[model samples]
Target: MTNYDSAFRWMKVKNGRLHFASIELDIQKNDFENKIVDDYLVNGFKNDSEGIKPWKKGLIRGLEFTLSKSSNFWTIVIKELQAPVLDSNPAIIGYTAILAFIEKTKIIIDEDDLRKIELFVYESWKGSNADKVPNFNKLIFE
Candidate 1:
């Protein structure tokens, strides 16, 4: 059992350009409705029995950018997260070519680690520099 063990679900499309919008699975509708009230984004996996420390948010692990079609994504131009180390491999490049897998799985997820991954994946979609992403799009609800 690790407090740093978390998973995320996200979606993306190549409209004018490739865009990514990822959310933690534990996130509820209230998470979206209340987002405006307070800017707090929560990552639900970092609070329990991870064996070590279990509470130090910094000691946890999480996701990183997996892929992008943009040339800047790999060729050392965008050395954001794992880009510096993971880009040299053709396998990783292949994983990124199809964006669907990246949408759901974070390469790494730690307990309460969703927020950091959210900032990297979700908040980027919210930026003025990026395209607009609706809180709820094609994802179905019951």
Candidate 2:
């Protein structure tokens, strides 16, 4: 068993209105509701399926969300980012765009933030199914 097998506490966006990943992800759903609504992003919602006219929007938003999530990886290659985006674009996808917009500025979070994120993830990693055989909750991530 690993420490992640049991996440005692978590710090999350509160209540940002995700399409619904796992119920456990919404620890402070009400608190971050505004942020969530504003971001209005999701993940894994690919198009070419769903057959719904509105599905494309969701798919695009999900792709953005996925890109944003991947942006955190840039923190490891901090030096590669230029300068303009260093101040803005906290989210991963936004940072990528910011770099594209700016001529010379790339973005990278410092080691401290990376460590914090790492610790947060470590502390957040509860087992998939530990409490009950079919515990059907806690899969939501905000």
Candidate 3:
């Protein structure tokens, strides 16, 4: 099992909403949050678009994610952006989208633990709510 295996098993669900405290703590302890942010900024944004277009798009989408308390990075990417559901789990995609959102918003998360909270949310969703596997054609031709 991976380091987060037990954490995933110990997920808490309250009021039909999953809580990610355990996973968030694990990510912070392992220092994966910085890697997630740096990778998203340097690789994800650059490879996804050219020039400032990606930044502008990220800001817009980020704001949308932030303002919609009912929506999240995974839902926005899947339903709004129509991103192809691929093999990579929701945790990774949600993490990047969250970083972009955090970048565009005044939400004051700690710089060192930036991705921790988002990771928790996404991980919890993946473990407790999301389908066991991704549907590659969920947004086919969209």
Candidate 4:
């Protein structure tokens, strides 16, 4: 097995409901996150991880394509957005669409790797004039 031969459960929307799919993928460890964080610190904007995006987008795209053989590549856009979904006490259904699927999956990654993902995502959402991601100071957790 390769270093990143790991399994993660993925979910997609179909017929106004969630469709579950599982697959094993190869996740190569890299300094993508560290670089993003570093760039954010120095330049006030993180702009690395072009290498990791393909790997991540490919996994989500594959799962989405399997659910529906549509010819749209927007799934990658949503996957990369990682937008903030309000965590309410009752939890609104439609509003939590993307997050619900993500919370159900189990992926194997070292702390460093996980940290990288978090950093990259944070930087993406943290808003930078260079990237136009507006620092929305919006807290996601309730």
lDDT (CA) for every model shown? 0.23, 0.25, 0.32, 0.26
> lDDT: which candidate is best?
3
- How do the residues 1-142 of candidate 2 rate in per-residue lDDT, one tens digit apiece? 1122221222233224111121001112132222222222223222233322222232223223323533322211111111121121122222232223221223343555445433332322244211111100121223
Query: Which candidate, 1 or 4, has the higher lDDT?
Result: 4
Q: After superposition, which runs of candidate 4 have C-alpha atoms over 4 Å from their true positions? A: 1-105, 126-142
- Measured with C-alpha atoms, the lDDT of residue 106 in candidate 2 is 34
Give the alpha carbon lDDT tens digit for every residue of 49-114 in model 3. Answer: 443333334323333444343222322221122222232223333334445444433355455444
- 2 against 4, candidate with superior TM-score: 4
Identify the runs in model 1 with alpha carbons over 4 angstroms from their true place.
1-9, 12-108, 131-142
Candidate 3 deviant stretches above 4 angstroms: 1-82, 88-94, 105-107, 118-128, 132-142
Ranking by lDDT: 3, 4, 2, 1
What's the lDDT for candidate 3?
0.32
Best by TM-score: 3
Per residue, candidate 4 scores C-alpha lDDT tens digits across 1-142 of: 1112333333334334333323332222243221111111101223346533332333333233222322222221122222112211111111222232233333222455334433333333222311222111231211
* Per-residue lDDT over 1-30 for candidate 1, one digit per residue giving the tens place of the 0 to 100 score: 212233222234322334322222221222
Model 4: which residue pairs collide?
Answer: 127-133
Candidate 3 has which clashing residue pairs, if any? none
Tell me which of candidates 2 and 3 scores higher on lDDT: 3
TM-score per candidate, in order?
A: 0.19, 0.21, 0.26, 0.22
